[model samples]
Target: MEALTTMKKKKTRLVVRKGNENIALKVEDIAFIYRDNTIIVAVDKEEKKYLCDRNLSALEEELDESMFFRANRKYLVNIQYIRGFKSFEKVKLEVSLLIPTCNHSIIISQETAPLFKKWINEE
Candidate 1:
């Protein structure tokens, strides 16, 4: 009998929509993912926003844990795009990103702050 081991497949890019056009963006180039109404949006380092077909939860599963962190219910932030973070009210955290999103607020819960701290420090 042969045993099957799952391989860690890293996703390099994703195909997203900009109007009627489908564009492939490198995962490393993405700044963050956010929810806007019923749509999921992917923002790049250049601050360009693209419409993603996958929901936030679905995208969360696909993204690398080392590279991305779910800041809240509405945001999945890339480590490469993190500018800084601060302590927020009520034991929460406020994160500032290099690429800004007009519609979403970037904040992390108290429980996730310690984990986020460790992730950012890893080489």
Candidate 2:
């Protein structure tokens, strides 16, 4: 029970950079996090983007897994922003978000499709 509670207790605020300014954004407002070349970016529900100092893997560990999913190597998606998913090229699953991503589609490989399905369906 203690371990579960600790895991569920995620960081409420994330410190992100916007040019020279460092802003503390509420985690709930974040729609997704993605790797853009060498930089990690966080997108909010309003479609605003901010730069994260941490890498995708590090952010993934800090976030509550129940609210976020590793959609692909590039994206850490918030479940609240996911609209739906569909078959992609017959072998993969393509995820659609409520807010559009950075002109790229979120794809789940065939091997990870089952895990993604279970995560999405869980209470």
Candidate 3:
């Protein structure tokens, strides 16, 4: 039997609160997003944590189409800043991108392969 999957293409907006200040961050400028116990760690050009109570699945819908991509379970990479992809694997792609820290390899889950390709193809 075929697998069941629901794909969504949209931009994610993060509402962050640093003390008493609130800010909105776009998923486009995001370098990579990780998890930290209760908070979702999303690193953009500027360093800050966008507060959200939703899981990765729900957040995926809130994110923009061309800006962010779900690249494995722990990371959501921004396409604008992505240099390109690497073909160093036989099964999945050897994902490489330019995020704040450094250029490193990211894991593109086999399940999300088609969406990732479609995202890159878009101009």
**Candidate 2: how large is its RMSD?**
2.2
Candidate 1, residue 21: lDDT: 99
Question: What TM-score do all the candidates reach, one by one?
Answer: 0.88, 0.90, 0.69
- Of 1 and 2, the candidate ranking higher by TM-score: 2
Better of 2 and 3 by lDDT: 2
In order, candidate lDDTs are 0.86, 0.91, 0.67
At residue 45, give the lDDT of candidate 3.
64
Clashing pairs in 1: none
Candidate 3 global CA lDDT score: 0.67
Q: Give the TM-score of candidate 1.
A: 0.88
Give the C-alpha miss distance for residue 29 in model 3, angstroms.
Answer: 2.7
The TM-score ranking, best first, is 2, 1, 3
Query: How does residue 64 of candidate 2 score in lDDT?
Result: 84
lDDT of 2 at 65: 90
User: Looking at model 2, how many pairs of residues clash?
Assistant: 0
Best by TM-score: 2
